[model samples]
Target chain A: MKHQFGDRRRLLQLSIAAIGFASASLALFIFMVTGTALIVVWVGVPVVVETVVKVRWLAELHRRRVGELLGEPIESPYLRRTEGNLLDQVRGLLRDPATWRDTVWLIANGTLGLALACVAVCEAVLDLLFWWLPPGLAMRAYARLSRALLAPSEKSRLALRVEQLTESRAETVDTQAAELRRIERDLHDGAQARLVALGMNLALAEDELARNPGAAKALLSEAREASSNALAELRDLVRGIHPPVLADRGLVGAVQALSLVGPVPVEVHSDLIGRLPAPVESAAYFAVAEGLANAIKHSGAHHMSITLSLENDLLSMVVRDDGTGGADPSRGTGLRGIARRLSAFDGALEVSSPPGGPTELAMVLPCASSLPKTLPSYGTA
Target chain B: MRVVLAEDLALLRDGLIRLLEANDCEVVEAVDNGPSLLRALTTHRPDIAVVDVRLPPTFTDEGLRAAIEARAQVKGLPVLVLSQYVEQLYARELLADRSGGVGYLLKDRVFNVAQFIDAVRQVAAGGTAMDPEVVAQLLTRRSGDKPLASLTPREREVLEAMAEGRSNAAIATRMFVTEKAVSKHTNSIFSKLDLPPSEDDNRRVLAVLAYLNG
Candidate 1:
């Protein structure tokens, strides 16, 4: 009985989505005609191009909606022309089949779309007016028609998948290179510098030891200090590479331990039932740590809170800070690293820090494995 | 005078024993692993224990764990934990009970023979001797604090020195300032940081640390 009602509700949603597209397409058609007519003045250049982009965006939404109604995935088929001159872009849009399909969709939506919506609404009213009237058959027919027009072919779906894989692969390579540079810079500035000083001090101490034992003691102490500091730097470097604490305490405890080191107070609330895959746990840990570090360093924030929970296959974490807001991905800082860090896991992050207030960052990772991993006999201490 | 030492590395362990003996402190027992350290602690009931952060039988925080466990068994048992890299989290864990007789210092501090001996003796006498790095970590927690902003740069340096459990004379000598001048700055810091007038330096340091941790 619930499934039947759910189907009915889905049918209603499908009809409403179609109606929304139909109205939007009518306005879009009006704008396109004006945009083309005013092309001689070049005032419509932006307008026409923007409409073209808007249509593609609208088709993506439509495809996603139709796919949701079908309870499956629907991939966008447009080979996105993210680079080109303006003339080439316009030509490219005109040359694309998806653009012409959008035009056909607009025209069809303008005519049959309006008729179908009116009939669907009137049928509901008539059903209320009468006793035994069901609109399932008509709604199902409309869904089928929309699907036939919008769904991508098998070959195009494969193409879309390949494009996505290639882009992510390229990004992974770039991220790796950037990370190596960062590690190299850290070593040069930290342990390497300290070791050089330590080596020099040891050499000088050797010379002074035989003649001036008193001064030699001071020099030896300084050298010892340098070596220990170098060791400290290497320890920190190792921790950053992979925190042994994470292995001992798991994600929740590791995060708690980590936040204790933040300059500002951090409250972490995590509700996860079982362990995530080791790689996923590590990725999520660094992502949250980076968010906290940024808040402490740049945000000028007083207090921060991190909350993690699992919803279905996704583990979601939100880190919020009270600070001088304005966290932009385009600007410098480790904000961009969060994306690169999670991209490997098919995870995504969103930052919302408008100027002059609180910054809230949300990260979500799809986890297919929620079974708690068995503890290794020896996980550090 | 008596101490139990736990360190994994043979060379460092030997060096530390020589350093302690030279400083006139007796080594009651020395162990390289966590279990032996625990057994030694119980058997000797030494005046204090100096444990490394990472030890054998896991090599990750085993020494710290053993020290905490030993302290639990022996109330206010002075334990000065040495780590290659000191973390504020571990420092807080050591100080969490709000009981004295705890010192968490970076192993680098051992190079300064006089200061390291002073810290060991201080911890043995039931006074805390936090590493300068740990103190720096605490000071950073209150960065941009409105009250902290009122302090002069010199006064901030004085506070850093004080948080490392240094006496006014030691701070004065180190900063190249007179004792009277150091005292005046401490008075100002106490008022500006709004620390209640405390006579002893250890209580003052703890008060300042607690305030910073806030």
Candidate 2:
């Protein structure tokens, strides 16, 4: 009970302090605006500065109070300009929105805070002094009045809690639905669409074959091209969902698969003889693929080297190239997407590309003990 | 001519067999994977084998391995490996053996029916056929060499086309020139690179491959 009383007292004190500071600042502001030059220089300036400082202190106190109430640790933003020169300090003071708004709040809250403080003090004193009064005369009357004032507020609080829970659940359901829609769209637009077009082309070619041999030949050629294209597109779509090679042959084989598709010569070096976690392998594979794609398309590189190693319980990768080097991560979405993907696994990506030289991309992921039990054997066999 | 086809896709495998049969070549065996391809090669001993780059269990480099293994087994049996995409690594791996009668081409090349059939026939006859895209990649990779720097633009084109295993006639058609002019350019390219002048030999292809792989 004593602890509860002490908390209430602290809250009241902070409220009063905030109000007093705001009131003083507001009065000073009005005085300065009205061309009261003498008062502005003598009292208004100092009062404004003091009010600003006190309001900031109060805001920090309030943040701590709220954190304590919620049982969480939260740090507050505070002014820490101790080393600046006088002019810089003045400029900072003038530039900060907190300085002006807080000063206004302080000046305005002074009168309101004084009245609330007096009323609270009087109520506390009366309640304590009248402890011995008959329950029906004092305590019962006070409880009735307080209940009347807080009943509607208690009902609204319950309603707000229900609304918050419903909102959160709705958000979760919406996110899942969006993901499902995305997957469906990928299938429809990618592989299925191409297969349908291929079938149509084949039908047209078959019809034309009995009518005219020359036209049939052309149509047959188009059909063949469509079938080949559809095959390639379907292969890519299937690979996107889950590469069978990655599952069957593991990360090394997956990287080798990518290396087999690159236009430039890629030398793959790996000290990782074992398999990694599925997510880790996927992240690493995509990172290497995107890096290689960028290097080939934009770097104008002739030769590239990819190295994957396990160092100190971390899977690390480095892709380096000898090209016309100026690679900027900010200019491309590929690197940014890679960074986001790596962040999901608590991995780190670093790039070093100086102008007119070699570009290197390095990534490290923590997957020491989480590797798969058995490593698949893969070779040119 | 006799041929063995190995492709993982059932539709493509069947279509290719029909096409080969229609072209009057005997397809002795049709298998779906690299291991089966090797098995069929040993059992049938077909005159030529057409393989795909990606095959069963793991579709990475199984076909390339099968081709290399078949070459090792048969000594000089012709092999043609088709791929949807071209990679310099695979080309280097195939050319690394340096034996005669090998072909690496993009699968789309089959759309040009006459040309693709000719390529198959050429490889079966102890000759080489490579895709122009693969040859272009090889040339770009080798552009930094001092020896390659001496060739003129037209000579370079001729060299690249030759690396694709195009005969003088095909080279003439592609370059929009007469066969005599292509022959003259080929001769100049050989002499400029200090290669032996073997007119009867298909030395242009050999010269381009040497420059690209070297």
Output the number of the lDDT-best candidate. 1
For all candidates, state DockQ relative to the true structure.
0.32, 0.11
Clashes of each: 0, 11
lDDT of 1 at A133: 51
Worst 10 residues of 1 chain B by lDDT: B205-214
Docking class of 1: acceptable
Interface RMSD of each: 3.1, 7.1
Candidate 2 lDDT over A1-381, as tens digits, reads: 566555555544544443443345446455434423433455544444544455566645544543443456334333343346544554566655445544443443344433544454454445445544321222222223322321224334454455555655565466457757876887688667867877787788788878887887777677677676766675556666556557545678778767755668788998888767666787788888888888998888889999999987788889999998888878778777566556655677888999986999898887747555343434422
Off by over 4 Å in 1: A1-142, A152-166, A184-197, A211-222, A243-250, A257-263, A272-277, A296-300, A311-313, A324-326, A330-333, A354-356, A367-381, B143-159, B175-209
TM-score of chain B of each: 0.84, 0.89
Model 2, residue B73: what's the lDDT? 86
Worst 10 residues of 1 chain A by lDDT: A372-381
Candidate that scores best on DockQ: 1
